[model samples]
Every structure is written in C-alpha cells, then in structure tokens.
Target: MFVLIWATFLLCVCAETGLSQKPRVKIPTLTEGQQATLTCVAPGLCSGSAPEITWTWRGAGGTESYITGSSTSFRTKTLTAFTQRHISTLTFNSSAEHHNTNVTCKIRFTGEKITEGGSTLKVNYVKEVNITGGTNVKEGETLNLTCSVESFPPSLIMWSKLGSDITLHNDTGSATLSIINATTGHSGQYVCTAKHMNNTLQENINITVIYIRTPQIIGNTIIKEGDVLNLTCSVESFPPSLIMWSKLGSDIILHNDTGSATLYIINGTTGHSGQYVCTAKHMNNTLQENINITVMYIRTPQITGNTIIKEGDVLNLTCSVESFPPAVIMWRDLSSKTNSKDTGAYTDLQNDSGSATLVIQNVTAEDSGQYTCTATHPDTTVTSSVSVIVSWFSKIQDVSECVLQAEVLTCVCISEGFPLPTIKWPLLGNHKEYAIKTTVSNHTVNSTVSLKVKNHGNSTVECVSNNEKGEAKKNLMIRSVSDTVADSSVLNVGYLEIIIAFLIGVVLSAVVCCLIKKCSRKKTKNSGNLDETLEMVTSQDDPQVFMFIWLFFFFLHNYKVFNCAQISSLLKYTYLVFWFSI
Candidate 1:
C-alpha cells in the first residue's frame, strides 16, 4: 500500500509540470521566390528549468527531416529576459514545391520532458499561362475566352489585345475575355498574362471574323438606239467574290468575272430592252441586284396623199413614222420659191399617233413643186419627198381686117390664144399667094395673114382660130372699082358738048356787035334814016349768022369724032380759048 501511494504522488506532480509547458509552431504563407519563416517556440512557464526548441518539416512527397541551427534553411534562438523561452526559426526562398508541407516544433525540458506542435505551410508561385477557346468566329456572334494559370497563391491574371495597349481584363485570379457582337475590326491576336511577385507569364491567340456584302449594279440602264449597252456589277467581300450579269428569267450569262464584271451589246435594239440581274456569289452566300433597261429607236419617215394636183384645186398630204419614244414630224417645202402663196402654204397638224398632215387650199400654178417630210428622233433623222403638178390656159385676141389700093388688095388676119391655136384665112385662096407669120410669148400665141387681089369684085373675107378647148371665127367685106371708072367717063363727055354750044353763040354775038356799031354812026342823021338802016342791017346779019352757025356745027361734029382721051384734052383747051376771046 505504501509503494502505490508514493508512485501516485510523483505522477501527479509530473502532470502539473506538463500542463505548464507547451510547444508552439508558426508557418506563414509566401509567394514563389520570396522569403519564408517558420517559428517554433518553447513555453516560458517551465518548472524548475528552461527548455530547448527544435523543428522538423514533412515534404510534399511524404519525406520528413529535422531542422536545426546548423541547417542552411533553419535558425534557432533563446530568450531569457522576461521569462525563459526557446525558439527555432526556419528561413528559405519559397517555391511551389513547398505548398501543403507540414512543419513540427518540439520542446525539451529538464528530467527528459518532451512536447511537440505541428503546422501546415502554404506557398504561392506562378507556373504557366494557358488560353482556352476557339479563335475562329463569325461576325455578330458572342465570343468566350478563358485564361488559366497553374500556380500557388493564385497569381494575378490580365487580358489585352496584342497590337494595342488596351487591357481587356485585370484581376487576381484566372481571367475570362468576352466580346458580344464582334465585328471584323475585333479580329487579330489577343494576349493573356499571369503575374506574380518577380514573375510574369504570357500567352497569345489569333481570332478571325467572317462576313459578306450584297451586290450592286452601276452605270445608266437607259440606252439610245444604235448605241452600245454597257453595265457593270460589283460586290465587297474577303477572298474576293464571283460576279455575273444575266437577263431576268434566262439562264444565259451575259457577263462573268470576279469582283466586278461588264456586259456590252454592240448595237442595242428594242428587243434588248428588259429586266437584267446582277449576281454576286461567295462561299454559301448569294446576293442579287435587278435593273430594268429601256431602248429607244425610230423608223424612216413615209409620205402619203395626193402627189399630182391641178390648178385651183385643194392639196392634202400626210407624213408618218414609227418609233419607240415617238418621233417629231415636220413638213418642209423643197421648192419654196414656187410655194410663195400664203393661201396654199404648208401647215403642221400634229397628232399623238406619230403622224402629221399638211393642208393647202386653192392651189395655183405657182404651187406646183416638190415637198419634203422630215422625221426627227433624239439619235437619228429621216426624210421623204413628194411632187405636185398643175395645168392652165390663156385668153384669145382680135381676128381680121382688110385694105385696097389701085388694083391691088391686102388682107391681114391676127389671132392670139393659149396652147398655140391654129389660125386659117380661107379668103387667101392659095398658100403661095399669101404670107403668114407666127409668134409666141409665155403661154400665148399670135398669128398674122397677108393676101394680094387678082380680080376686083364685091366679096367677103373670113378668119378662123381653133385650140384644144374651142374655136372662133371673124368676117370682113371688100368692094370692086371697074364699074365706077366707066360711069365717070360718060359724065365727062356730056359736059364737053354743052361747052361747044356756048362757043358758037359767042361768035354770033361778036358779029351782031359790029353791025350795031355801024347803026349807031347813022343814028346822028335822022330817026327814019336810023330805023331804015337798022332794018337793012338786020336783014344783012341773017346771012352772016347762018354762015357762022354752019361753021360752028362743022367744028363740033369734028370734035365729037375725036377719041375719048383726045376729046378730054381738046375740051379743056377749047373752053380756055373761048373765055379769053370773050
């Protein structure tokens, strides 16, 4: 019983000493390439004597070793100023291999008392940077990128574009880069960087953007007649795009090339006017543009209506042409000089049917000429011609007159008419016996006739004028001179016989005068003697008067026997002689 009690008292005292002294260990977290500290401390409350501190560490691979003052990475210290304490310090350059390592601290007291404490050591370091995600992406889609780093203490990570100084993300952990609705400008290389104390790591990735654009048609689609039809097609894209031009609803390709193409028609016509399409093709993408083409053309002008027109008649003409855009029709007088009349001039009457009419009223001979019809278009012009004809006549003038001299007679007949009228003088008898002359001026004709007379008699002369239209006649009277000359000769002979009887009476009177003179001489003697003498003188005078009368009668008979030409001369001489003697 005594041995059991003594052993129990010693065990109680030892338990009290153990409770007063304990070992402490401190292990601090550190980055790679930085200094690390692990501390082991012996309790100051020790009974009767001070304790000694020791340290040991367990490696990541489950290996264990003691740390002492002589070790290169461990150090120890003892403090006795306030109270007795023992410390063991650990020093080293940290690395990722030191993570999750176990450190132990032991305390040795007097009488062979030992106590130990353990701690876990945490270390921080950066190993490498890795990028995760696809680099190739379509435009307008979301992009996700992850930047991962293998390290201890979780290194700071950041993302940035390669060609610029802009930072996409910056944080103390793994970085994620997200881009919403990316475009072509968002393409190129990107960098992810992992940073730790005195250490940096980087990784790069290339991103590509894909897209397509619609096609376009360039140049004017409206083409003139006989002009070249030109068109071009273009598109914008990467890797170039296929371009083609074709008419709508037709498989035939008008033009085919890359990027841009041109279609040309040598001489465009109305048939070539329609809807055309421009197509641009890329990888699994197609774009099209539609264009409508119009062609303009004109046909030659045609002239119609009356070409031959008579004088004083109405004239009508029409000009027509066919065209797509409608042509301008006009009438022109080719013979402007002949169409100088204001009433029968060319006039324009335009209509919507591509035709024009030219009307002329009361056309005269001056209006006979050629006329032209012209059709004009924007690109070309055409012309046609027509001719007009006219016919007319002139008036007629004086017919016939006559004159006679001595035994010759002359007759002249004149007629003036249009279209050269035929004139005849029937009184001229033979053609050789008469002279004829004709003259013409403008549309008028003049004819003259002359005739000679061989016989003297009362007769009639006539002239006749005829033409294609009608005929006319004129008559004149002519007198004979032979009977008038014979009547004048008889009156002249009777006057000569009266002159002879007067001459005989004149001779008797002269004899009586001589007898009277003798009687007057005797009258002085006596009245009786005068009377007897006058009676004797009268008886004597009777014989003398008888003898004188016989002589006068004989002379007169002799004169009557003379020829008519001679008697006319003798009578004139005898009458002059008798008057002079009286």
Candidate 2:
C-alpha cells in the first residue's frame, strides 16, 4: 500500500524530491445528509521548514476553490529535530451533489517546487424507490414499466411481478419491464426493488389488464313438453363481467348476476318456445349469445259428423288435433265392410297439417257402421270414433185382403213398408173392438186386422196403412145376409159365373119367343104348324129351341145348379106335355 500510494503522489509532483514523497490516500465514500472526514499528510523525509499543506475543492463543472476555515483544521506531529512530519484533515456534511467532485492536497516546499495529490469524491445515498408508467394495460398492446432510485454509485433496481419467481427487470438506478402483445394473463401486482449497500427498499404497483374473453352459452336448444329447461352464460375478464339472460323482444330479465347467469323454465310448454339470449356486460363493452328452444306437445282429437243420416245422403266427418311441429292423421272404418267403395258407398280421406276429413258419398245401408279417426305424432297418438246410421221412407205392398168365417166376420189386410207401417181398419167410422197383428221380414211389414160384423151387408170396409213416408187405403164390399147364410149355389159358382149365366138366359129367351111368333104369324096352315113348332121348341128335338128352354130353366134354378148338373126325365116330360096342351 505504501509503494502504490507513494508512486501516485510522485506522478502528481511537478519537481523531483529525490527522496520518497508522502503516500496518497483513498477518498472516503459519504452518504447524503451524513457527517464525513478526509486527511492529507506531508512526506516525513522532507528537508527543512515543515512544508505548508492545504486542501482545495473542484466541482464537476471544473470550477476550483479553497476548502477553508472552520471546515478545515491543521495538526502537526514532531518526529526528529532535522526532519518533521506534517498532516491536514478536512470535515463537512455530504450529499448526492458532492459525488464525483474533485478534492486535492497541495504542498509548497522552501526550495520553490510545488506538488499535490487529489481524489474523486464518491457519495452513497438512495431516495425512495418508485415506479413509472401507466398501471392499466390494454390487451394485445405493449406493456411498458420502469423502476428507479436516485442514489450515488447508482442503486441496484429490480422489477418483478408479485406472486411470481421470475424477475421482469434488473439494472442500476433504472429498470424497465416490457412485454409485447400482452394478454389478460398479464394482469397482476408488480414490485420494484431498489437495493443500496446495506439498505434495501421496495415499491409495489398493481397492474390490471383491461380485456374481455368470448362469451359462452350452454344449454339444450330443444325441450319436450312439461320438462324443465336450463341455460347458462359465462365470460372471463379483468373485473368479472356481468351476465344476464332474457328472451328476444322481451325486456324482462330472466337471470342476472356477476361472472355467470342461469335461466330456467319450469314445465315448459308451447307458449314458452322461442329465442333466448345470454348477454355479458363488461366495462364499455357488451357481448351476447343466443339459442332457441322448442316445446313438443299434443292435444286431444276432435271428431265432427252426424250419427243418423238419410239413406242417400253424404256422411262427412272431420278429425282435428293441435300440436307443435305438425302430426300425421289417419281414418279407418271399423265395420266388417272394409270395402265400402262398392254398393254405391265410398269414403274419401283428406289430410292437412293438423286435421283429417272423411267424406262418405252416396251413403247406403252398407255405409252404416262404426268409424274411427286417429292423429299420430312423435310423442303420442290421439283417436276418436263415431257411429253412422241410414234411414229410408216407408211404403205399402199390394197383397192386402179380408176374409169372413162363421157368424163372425173377420178381415185381414196385409201390407209391406219400411219402418213397419201401421194398419188401421175403419169399418163403420171408429171401432175399438177390432184386433190388429203385425209381422216383419227384412224391410217388409205385414199387418192383419179382424172384427165381427153381423149386419155388415151392402156396405164397404176400409183399410188404411200409414208410416213416416206415406199412406195407402183399400175397400172391400160386404155381401147380403142370405148369401152369407145359405148361399151355397151362388157361393159355389161365384158372382162372376152367375152374371154370365143370367146374360145367356136372357138372349136365349128372346130368340125362342121370336121364332114362336113368326110361326104363329104364318096364318091357317098356322093353327096346326104353330102347334107343331111349339112342340118342337119345347120338346128338345130342335137344338136351338132346346138350348133356349134349358138356359131359361137354369137361370130360375141357380140353387138346382149347385144341387145337380143332370136334368130329371120325368120333370122334363111333364113340362113337354103341358106345353103341348097350351
């Protein structure tokens, strides 16, 4: 140390002492606002006079001045009589401005040669640690941060993010942390550390990245009837975003919260099916997501048609059901006659979105049966049934008659009609004593009526039959009492034969009389010829005359005709003899 210092001092001397000069000393490092001291000594081997030693100060700008008076004091120590050792010391308060300034010690020898040794002043101090630049950073932009401290010898500065091991910046006096294309993950608290020798200081700054992530909506878009519907919305941001749920075109808020929101629909139906929206609200920014929900349901089936119809009328039926996402419709005839198209009956089926129509044309008895309608959907099926009947007008048949037996006159009238026509007998006007019987076969109806009429002669009995459609009547003539009693001959031949017999008798009588008169008009020869002609006409000898006589007798002997067809010979002979006498 002595040789190094002695060489430094020798370099500063303007003239050679030939002997070793005093050694140079290291400048003291002074902290700001603290007391400091400095010392300089003259060479102990110097000859003569105890050389004068003084201290001067030069600023960093190169301006020089004497360090004077009360800040500087001199002390001397006696060594030997011939050569004496001399020293000087300077004292003052130190600050950061005094750092890097020059201070020098000067000595003037009695030989008129001057030499000096000087050192640069160093002061150690540090102000408080601080961070600069914006605390908030936009996403995808450059993130710049600087940390610094004012201290002599330049304090060590460090930048680091809190809760992390990695250091962002490390330097002297000032440190900057820079990240390009920053993201939301870069938001956190940052720290700046200023380290001075034996003294440490730290500063903290909270950095937040202003950014928003894409919003997400989670749920089922379609829902069944009478089932719960759930939906959720969420987003990530610096300050957690606000999430809200709402239906499109409606202002009512279904759900609202921070960070996330959930929407629920209990027992969802067709009325609740529509578009739903999930929105996330951030600082000066709004994000949204949307979804659609559908509710599936079905209603009961409805049928429309008349149960009873005319025989030839049309039978129309309609089946309808309401549901979401339309359903399929079908028609079926439950009767045995599935092929209704025959027999002038046909079923026409028409289908639409939610309904079905069945048209039965030219309805007949075969068309009268049970019919069913069905509506089918993905979830369920609906059905309805109806009954059909065909009706027709009533009519009477022609085989109606009356009969008589014993003393009691009984009448029977037969008629056939649809819906069982009723038969009524108006014998006199009204008779409650009569009885009526009816029988039915298929669509035909037979009615029989019976009554006793003891004095029913030369009168007419009336029979009337009626039904919903129409009515019919007939009359029967009553015969005489004698004819009803002992009229065997008339009854045997019937009235038709009796009429023919009478007509023949009249014509024959005329011819026979005319011939007899013609013979009588022949005069003389007359008397004898007339007698002969009479005999011939009456005798059955001449065919024309005989036929006339026979027919005449037959007309008067109607009862005889029933008794015997043969004529008695004795009676005929007597008749002839009597005729001859006339």
Candidate 3:
C-alpha cells in the first residue's frame, strides 16, 4: 500500500509538469545600429484568459534591468513607446550601443504569480572601419596609412597596431599616420583605437618597408689618348648619408652629396680599369658596393686606290701605313689574282702581319689607277696606299667581208682587224686615189677606199691594223666583167640591143644632113637661073652621093629593124617555150 501511494505521487508530479509546460521561445538576431524586439506567445492559454507579460534585458556582465511591465499587474509587460504596434503588440526598439545585449520576454498566468517560459533577443551593429593605402613601402619612398571609422558624434579615434607603437591624433574623428621617405626600420603592425564614454573598439593593420639601391655611371666606356675621364657615383637614401669613393690607393671624400651618394673618378687610365667602390654612411652604419670596368681603345684607319686590272697586265703597287697597335687587313677588292672572272668566287690572301692584297680581273682602261688597302684592329687603326700600274694589249674584233664592181672588174675586201685598222687602194687601170672613209661600231671597224679601176684583171684590196702587239691584213682578188657574165645570155642580148640602137641613130643623122645640103643647093641654083625656067641638070656627084647615103641609111635602118624584130620574135618564142616547159 505504501509503494502504491509513492507511485501515485510520482504520477501526480509528472501530470502537473506536463500540464504547465510551454514551448521554448526562439531568440531573434539583430545587427548594429538597428532595433531589436522580443516576444512570447502562450499556446496553452485561451484568448479569453488574461496572460501577464514582463520584459527585461541582460548585459555581458550578467546585469539585469526591468524594461517594461503591465500597469495593473506586474506580470503583464507594456511595449516601449518607440515599438511598432503593427508587427507585434509587444515590442522594443534599441540602438547599436546595446549590441550583444539580450532581452527576455516572460508570460505568466493573470492571477498566478509564477512565470512561464520566455524568449531572448539579440542585436547586431555595422561598424565602418578600414585601413586605407599601401601596407608595403620601399626605402626612400613616402609612407602613408589611414584608419577610418564613420560613427556617430562623441566617438573617439586612436591609431595603433599589434606589436607596434600607439599613434594618437586630436580634433579629427579619423586618424592617419604618415612617414615621409621611410626605410626598412619603419616596418611594423598598426592599430586604430576608438572609444566613447564607457565604450571602446580597436582595429589592426600591417606595414613593411623595402630597401633599394640606385647608382649612376659617368664618361664613355671607350676612350682615346689624352682624354680626361670622369665618373660619378650616386644613390638614393633617407636620413641623409655621407658619400665616399675608394680607388686604387685610398678612399676619397665626395662633394655635392645630399640624399644621393656621389663619387668622381678624375683622369682615369688603365690603372683605373680595376674595381670602383662606393660607400654610403648613415648615422654610425655604412653600406658599400663595388663595380668592375674595362677600358676600350680608340683610332680609325684610311685607305686609298683602285683595285682592278686586265689579264696579262703587271700589277705594280705599294701599301703605306700609320697607326698604333698596327691595323690588321680584313677585306680585299680583287679577292684572287687567278680565276677572278668566275662569278662570286673570291680569295683571301693575308700577309703574316695581317695585311691583305685586293686583286680584280679583265681590266680595261677602267683598271688603271691607285688602290687603297686598309688594316683594322681593336682600339687602333692604320691605313696604307698601294700604287697599281696595269698594262694590257688591244684585242681584235668584228671581222666583215664585202664585194665591189666596176665595168669588167671585180674586187673583194676583207676587213678583219682591231684597233681601227687603216685601208689603202692600189692604182689600177686609170683610177685616181682619193680620200678613204672609216666606219666603226662597238666590236668592229670598217675602212672604205675610194678609187677607180678599168681593166678586167686580177687585183687585190687590203686592210691593215696595228697596235703595240702586232699587225693583221686582209686581201681579195678581182675578176673581169666578161668572165663574170660569160655563162649568162641576158647580158649578150642587152649588148646587141645597144649596138643596134647606136647604128640606127647614126643613119638618121646622115639622112638629115643630106636633106639639108640638098635644100641649100636647090635654093642657090634657083637664085642663079632667075630669067628662064625649064630642064634642070642632074649632077653625077649628087646622084652618087644620094645613092651612097640611101644605101647606108637603108642598111642601118634594116639592121636596127632586124634587131627589134629579133627581140620581138625571141619574146614570142620564150613565151611558147615557157608554156611548154610548164
């Protein structure tokens, strides 16, 4: 019975806990500079039941404060004056300063003093904070950094970084720190400190400095004799550093040195060709560096003359010189003395001393002159002049042949020679000697001899050409006209026609003279016998003369007429023969 009673008590306690239990309230999140609201609903309580509500806030330190409560009943909480009534009948509006603060909402029975379950409210804030500008800086460069936090008034701003010094600026809400011409030693972390009454915030930034070196060079790398050499050294620095130069013997002080390190090398020489050191001194420390240099030599050479000649021509010349370290021959004009005519083929023949000979080929008058051969070497130059004398023989060109004719004579002249050969005609028959004309072309020269020839005999025409080398002559034979035309019948026919025409002309002339003389005699006879007219006497001499004249004229006329008739007959026969032949 006692066990049953204990079980009944446990059952009664479980039932009471289950009937009074309420759902756990969910907490709403908030941001900085915004409002937060807390609310609780009693699912077990009916609408007609009057439930009481109370709201309070708890800070980070666990401190609690009464925010609101019902006027009639302390369990019923009233909304704040700034709360919106539309979204919820119970609400509260709070600022960013209350960020992370928790608001608790408790619901209770109207007549019961005990509270039910509650909910929590969380608030968030957006703080505008950033570090502006470059965190890494090179030595000898300006360094600047800024920390900005746009906040409400009465907010304090301070600058600092982790493992760094605290930087403070007054009067401005934003803090900025700047280092002009900074160095590697100025690198560290930076932090910004901002505070208000009973409130404080902080941010951090990192900064690093890079170191660099700059140096300057002076004068020409290549120098001539008696030239003044000047070199200057410089570098970029901060905090002002001392400049000095170390040379062969000792170190020297440099002038005009400010942020830059300047060093000068005066009257440099081969001895100065070694290493040059530049040192920069800042406070008690010094940085040094050295550079190597090599000096170059100076000089230019001159060349003179023509480098060409003809075959079989002797080349006589010399090359003169004037220079230091002696110039070496590099190139030649002719290349080689033999086989120089081959295209693109060249020769390189250098003396043990490095001088070279330039030979060219097939030289005409163009090959005559002096030539210049130059020798080249590093740092110094020398030149030489060669006097080249060329000798060559003239060559023959353009051989031609022609034939001439006069009457029964024929002649052939062979004009084959060079150097413009002279021509002469032999006295033949009754021809007179006259001037000779010469015609010349690129490869050939012609000589024409003007003279007369009357006989059909063997004759020769000659042309001779001469130079420093030797002379050459050309000859041709002449033949008679009859011999030349003996095999042709056309010439014989033409000659016969000429002969017949001549005979006819002579007969006509005789007839005309006879008629004139007869008329004149008749006139004279009439004048002497004017008294009577009758019988006329026939003189025997006149009749005989007339008869002889008539006979002579008839024969001459017949001869001419017969010749013409023969020619016409021959033409008719030739037409018939040609037709038959065809």
All predictions: root-mean-square deviation over Cα? 25.2, 22.0, 25.3
Off by over 4 Å in 3: 1-31, 41-52, 66-91, 94-101, 107-112, 122-125, 129-134, 137-216, 220-229, 234-243, 246-252, 256-260, 264-276, 280-287, 291-582
**1-582 per-residue lDDT for model 1 (tens digits):** 986676566555644655575667776767767777777766543223455566677886687874332232333333332223456776777777767777777776676767888877777767778889878777789788999887766778899999788899877768889999988888889999888777788899998776667787877788887789988888877557889999999999988999889888889989899999998887778889999998887777887888776557788888888886778888777566745465767533343347888878888655667777878877677878888764443333544455454544545455544335676677656545444445455444544443445665657667677766567776755533453443332122346455653564466557657666655323334654544333433335357666765665566547755333334444454556556655
Provide the global lDDT of candidate 3 against the true structure.
0.49
- Output the lDDT of residue 294, model 1: 86
User: What's the lDDT of the predicted structure labeled candidate 2?
Assistant: 0.69
Task: Output the better candidate (1/2) by lDDT.
Answer: 2
Question: How well does candidate 1 score on lDDT at residue 53?
Answer: 62
Better of 2 and 3 by lDDT: 2
Ten residues in a row with the worst lDDT in model 3? 81-90
Per-residue CA lDDT of model 3 for 1-582, tens digit only, reads 996676566545533542476534444665444444454544342222344555566766788775433121223223442211111124445555455555555555445534445444444433656669898787778978776665544356776557646554532467677789987777777777767445677777778775545545454544443455455666555445666667645656434465564444455455556666667775556776666654444244343444344445544333434333344664434523442546754343343233344444444443444344556656555544444444333333333332333442222233433233444444332464332334555324454443444553545554455544456555544333444545232122345545554554455466546655555223334565565444444444456654764575466447754333344433443444434433
The CA root-mean-square deviation of candidate 2, after full C-alpha superposition on the true structure, stands at: 22.0
Give each model a TM-score. 0.47, 0.55, 0.29
Per-residue lDDT tens digits for candidate 2, residues 1-582, read 996676556444413552246436445768788878888876554334556677888976788885433286666676544334567778888877678888888877666656688888888877888788888888889889988898866888888889887887899989999988888788888889888988989999888888888888888877779999988888877688999899999999988999988888799989889998888899888998888888888888888778777777888888888887677878777663545545645343556668888887888766767777777888688877788766565544444544554544545566655445777766635555454445567556665554555655635567777778678787754444443464342122235444544454455556556666654322234653544332332333357766756775665457544222222322333345445444
Candidate 1 residue runs with Cα over 4 Å from true position:
1-163, 174-194, 200-209, 223-227, 267-270, 282-285, 304-318, 322-325, 336-368, 388-582
Full-model lDDT for every candidate = 0.67, 0.69, 0.49
